[model samples]
Target: MTDWAHHRFTANDLLLDRQLVDSRGMMAGRIDDLELSDPEPDPAGGGSAARAPVLTALLCGPIAYGPRLGGRLGTWWAATGRRLRGDGDGYPCRIPLSLVARVDRMQVRLTSPRELLPSYRLRAWVADKVIAPLPGSGR
Candidate 1:
């Protein structure tokens, strides 16, 4: 179990697309992007040197995923997400970095259960707008 807070890591090398597992070991989702704290003066007291942004959260789902695709398809997908969200921001579900307990070759483990994560909002929306409208689905 790597202590992510103290370790130096490249987000793209270790995090993107990694499987996410909740405390109970249930599959939560894949990491689509990472959120970093705005750069700040180094806590180590380096006079004017700015510290690299620290990882703050994990972003998941289609809205975050689109940027990683990078090109015409990515642009179209992200725009579609913003249109669907209708809120302009279109930020995907964000799981705080504090919840992350471990990271390995293929997975990023969370200390809390998936129920505590906001990743389900998209699923709920789809159920309401798409699934519930199906002929056999009982609303």
Candidate 2:
């Protein structure tokens, strides 16, 4: 697994709610949660049987955001997202760790281009259906 120990920052303090940006510098979304790989045996045979968890992916979308928000409003938000997706998968969009370039004070930059991300589904739909048909909207 890739070692991120060199980076000194807590996930909750530095990552959560931070904006995600693609390689082309387009705003993708905000990070709601971090997906960590299951703990594995320490190769170095440390005192503890399990090593520290490895960062695997970043979770985005309403499905992820809802639970963090909590209460009835959170449930409704997640339900609305599920309805819009129209798919059996209720999980949030997961961006792999490999695609992440760097995490700064403000945003997490991705190695992949924006067009390749599934996170743009809602934005694309809104642009095509709601914004494109407006009177003065540039088609």
Candidate 3:
């Protein structure tokens, strides 16, 4: 694996709210939150571990975005997403860090296709149940 520790970009400046594009150049979603792994203890006898807390996944969806917004409305928005999901777990969609191909000033590009992402569940649901049923939606 390439050593991401050597990379100099700040996560907050480069990743937060950046658009995520799949390998097919399809828009998946904006990065709403980053999931970092806890530092693991080193087995080589030093007090410090070889790996520190590292970015593990990208979280996308209202559940992730709402906490960042931090207000009553944000809470409501997140709750609505949870209700729609009906999973009782309320966790936001997580895209593994391994799928990230590159990060630029405007967006983060993925190594996977957009259709494989869990983040598109709501959009797909709406399209199938609502948009597809419209009179002129080309059904």
Candidate 4:
């Protein structure tokens, strides 16, 4: 494994948009934001072990994603988002840190498929309402 210091990503580079994937290799969504935690020092010989930062969880979909992109648009987006679910849990999708299997290039591999999650409502809605209205919707 290459040392993180030698890796290509700068601090700003890490904050940009990226896609999130699942273990079955399905497209989960985009990496809207990162969840960070303080590092725990290893007690063994009082030395630091080599490891990438823990992933924690992945945030995705429009409602969850929009707020991360904060501003006027973000506020309107989040407000409209809440109305969609009608008091359903208005949470951005969260995938546990343990689910990640690998991180390569700009994509994350997970240990389970997206179907395992309950946040596919947006995907279904788009397909049913918007896309279904377009020409050759079934195709």
Candidate 5:
């Protein structure tokens, strides 16, 4: 059987909605978007693993993905994301290939969890200001 068949992922699976976590294993965010490069290369004499091909990057958050989703709506979405963030160019968090440990049915496990991640401002803001104030925030 093909390796992918053994792994069992269908192409049509919803990748965008998946949650991303930190190395210490806290919920970071969802997989807001993906980035890809041209398939041809190897001029630089870099090595590769025998069993797996290298991934260029894993992108998360609105700014990193906004441009890929083109047109005026994309622009609007990007701008709004920046405003909500309060400042900055709004680049999506880039997870390097080296940090990934494995991909199971529901989530991508990372070799380095939590130690390298920062607190997610938006999540905290929403939780503290909105959800936590509600009757069942902890539950």
Candidate 6:
């Protein structure tokens, strides 16, 4: 691995679609979207020192991936994700930036294990409900 260093990054160019590996070297997921920190409100209301929005979290799962896929398929994918989640809030699996230990060209490494992430439950559910019963799945 190359020496990790902080550098200016383009979200779309550098982050989008990058695979995420957990601390235990497990595949977590690919970065599908980002949640940015809202800039702090200026106390003076003068708009002179408005803080720039910063990255807050990395998002994954079909809910975050659908839009990027675009068109009808993307729409359907997102809808299906929301349906499976069974929630009105519809937020995807959020991996906070604080958990990210390293970011390289091919993957973003996390300080936590994949099983520690909420996405793990979703994947487990899919495996149990969708995949296990399929023919030749060998589950």
> CA lDDT of each candidate?
0.80, 0.83, 0.83, 0.64, 0.59, 0.83
- Measured on C-alpha atoms, candidate 6 has an lDDT of 0.83
Task: Please list the residue runs of candidate 2 whose C-alpha ends up more than 4 Å from where it truly belongs after superposition.
Answer: 1-6, 39-52
Tens digits of per-residue lDDT for model 6, 67-100? 9999999999999988988766689889988888
Regarding TM-score, does 1 or 2 come out ahead?
2
lDDT of 2 by residue, 1-139 (tens): 3234346888776789989999899999999988986566457855453556678899999999999999999999988888877787898888988888888777788888977887878988998999999988988
How far off is model 1, as Cα RMSD? Answer: 4.8
Residue-level lDDT for 43 in candidate 6? 77
Off by over 4 Å in 3: 1-6, 39-51, 135-139
Task: State the lDDT at 11 in candidate 2.
Answer: 78
Q: In order, how many clashes per candidate?
A: 0, 0, 0, 1, 7, 0
Please say which candidate is ahead in TM-score: 3 or 5: 3
In terms of lDDT, the poorest run of 10 residues in model 5 is 1-10
Give a tens-digit lDDT track for model 5, residues 59-138. Answer: 76566557757888778877777777775757666766566555545665666654464325666677789898889678
Model 5 C-alpha RMSD to native: 6.6
TM-score of 1: 0.70
* Residue 86 in model 1: lDDT: 67
What lDDT, from 0 to 1, does candidate 4 have?
A: 0.64
> Cα RMSDs of all predictions?
4.8, 4.8, 4.2, 6.8, 6.6, 4.2
Candidate 4 residue lDDT tens string, 52-108: 455456566567767777999998887777677666777766666666666656676
The 10-residue segment of model 2 with minimum total lDDT is 1-10
